[model samples]
Target: MTEITTAQPRSLTTALDIPRPPDLSWYVQARQPVGYEVNLTRGLLNPDNPALARSVGADGYTSVRTLVVVDKVVDGLYGKALRAYFDAWRVDARWKVMPGDEDTKNLEQAVEVTAAMTEMGILRRTEKVVVVGGGVLMDVVGLAASLYRRGAPYVRVPTTLVGQVDAGVGVKTGVNHGTHKNRLGTYFAPEITLIDPEFLRTVEPRHIANGLAEIIKMALIKDASLFRLLEETVAGIDGDALADCGPAMGEVVSRAIAGMLDELEPNLWEWVLERSVDYGHTFSPSLELRADPPLLHGEAVAVDMAVCVALAVGRGLLSQADAERALGLMVAARLPIAHPVFTPELLEVGLADAVKHRDGLQRLPLTNGIGDCVFVNDVTGDELRRALEFVHAYAGTRDGVRDGS
Candidate 1:
């Protein structure tokens, strides 16, 4: 056996007994003027038009180059015209087409798009990456652009009702992870969001309703006038009405976009906890991810908003009559007011998850009344359970009416 010798470790300790002036500690405040324009236009993809070029400051580049990531659906609908437009403008463009379904919107897709941008030698400072598609495409491509070289400027051209009025106007770039919706994402504002309501012409009726769900969310949370507009004009919000630029449909899109921007501008990074925009988001994330034959993003949001309406009513924050009116409006617009997957147990799980996201408290946004919102950190589990039950029952009653049963 080798002799084991232990060497004692000497500790060097010093105490500052003498008074020393504290190193001047102060925060360096920075006010970065970060803003993006939401350009509502028609015929943005037309070669003769300069909307796309001017929005991106294309002339600023010695050689105007664009890297476009398009949803396969959008490409199939308008890719030839878009390519021709780019050629006619003498804009150097590299196009990559991929399906933009929820299943395909993930970190893997982000990585793939980032790789393609790299291959195209994307100039992070000058060349713009234009994303054209619906919400999924916007999210995945935005994530890719945000991750490449820490952030490369990009433009959004949302080609769906939901995209234009809701997803496209905001700065959130995200992709689903495992069972969580928007689990991996960053808040990256686009250089510009070109919203052509004309895109809605190509969208399905159900998709139009999907977008209306978000419009309803904004109306319920922040703008009473917008809510009234939605209620009064719900009948004229179908696909054909939107394609024809009907006044009702036009107002819905414009007001929804404006209302959302109003809510987002003040708290771009969400340092503020009292966010009205979070009204439909907290509960919907889980419901959207867990549903079998999964729900559309706005569909899940509509259901969650119904649950919130119930919660508000139960708390005496919103009148029962107002709750009914809100639900009726959702019904009139053909949005889902309740979903079968929203069980009490799932509500508990979803709230728990939301609490984690909201930083250890349930910063749940409930309507003080329609068009006004307040956050509650002390929402009891019992209240949530009751809200779930009320929504389920109310939805059933509405369904019975619809079926004439």
Candidate 2:
């Protein structure tokens, strides 16, 4: 009889004697402050130079355990020197050599790197994985480090021009997934990035052009003075000249690095999608993954830039003369302005993918003028076709003259 009586439950509002909001949820806020150094020096591997040794931070320990991942080609060229430097600094460095090519930039390669780190028994906090190579290897190893034990510290020693100026400076690490470029990736910052232009001396000429394309992209969208410098020295600029570390080429490297960091530091995670640094990237991913012989990343970007230049002209965002000047600079730098695989259909597909990547709108970056950019949401297939046509025609004319009838 006593247990038969039921008690009424009190309302949440009445229990607390306060009004309850319509939504029932708790909000959490956090911030991850990212900071890293990009050090530029000559002779980074020189046993006498303390830059690389200092970066390794092996002061107290008899031998600090470190995993050093290097490009196969770079290892072939500089393996002895690297060994000597490590020995001189009394650092226990485990070497992992990987192919630093576009084809090797994939999830499997990243897994291989992670496996290497596992085999080395990488100490998560104390040890660092040092990647020495071009952009592709840097990306793969960065991705690997980001994945291993949730996240591991790593250093970047970019041996190629592209790695030195563009990819090496950024916090984005990715490997190509399926046919998509950088489909699986994470924004992981390295402990430090070491840049030594002396390494560019061994880079092939075509690869040099690859790096120039990215530099040109930065110049077009951010620094008119950088563009003027490139324009003035386009004819003489090559891997050899850059390796010489002359003033003009020196300025180009510094300015490109400065411009890229300026753009990247503010938008580390790309919280804002309308990135001016995305100028030639909208369509280049598809073109890069689809090309038959496999165009270099920068070559694909060069072609994509050519198309964007044409589109900019059509939209009156950039003058025809400036567009021509841009295209001519690409040509002078020995970069391809067009590729057979970059068809209108591919452009449409790439734009669709870009729209999704940019979050529902085109957000297509166009060069408003030299050193300035504007983003647009509306870009039709017709406009893309027209831009492709103009690029093709321009390439044809340039080829014809170069071929001398």
**Which candidate wins on TM-score?**
2
List candidate 1 stretches off by more than 4 Å: 1-31, 59-63, 400-405
Top candidate on lDDT is 2
User: How do all models score by TM-score?
Assistant: 0.89, 0.92
lDDT of 2: 0.90
10-77: candidate 2 lDDT, tens digit per residue = 98779877645665557799999999999999999888798887777776347887999999999999
Candidate 1 — what's its lDDT? 0.85
The Cα local distance difference test for each model comes to: 0.85, 0.90
Name the regions of candidate 2 deviating beyond 4 angstroms: 1-25, 400-405
TM-score of 2: 0.92
The clash count for each model shown is 0, 0
lDDT by residue for model 1 (8-72), tens: 86544324344345753456988767888999887787766788877555553345788989999
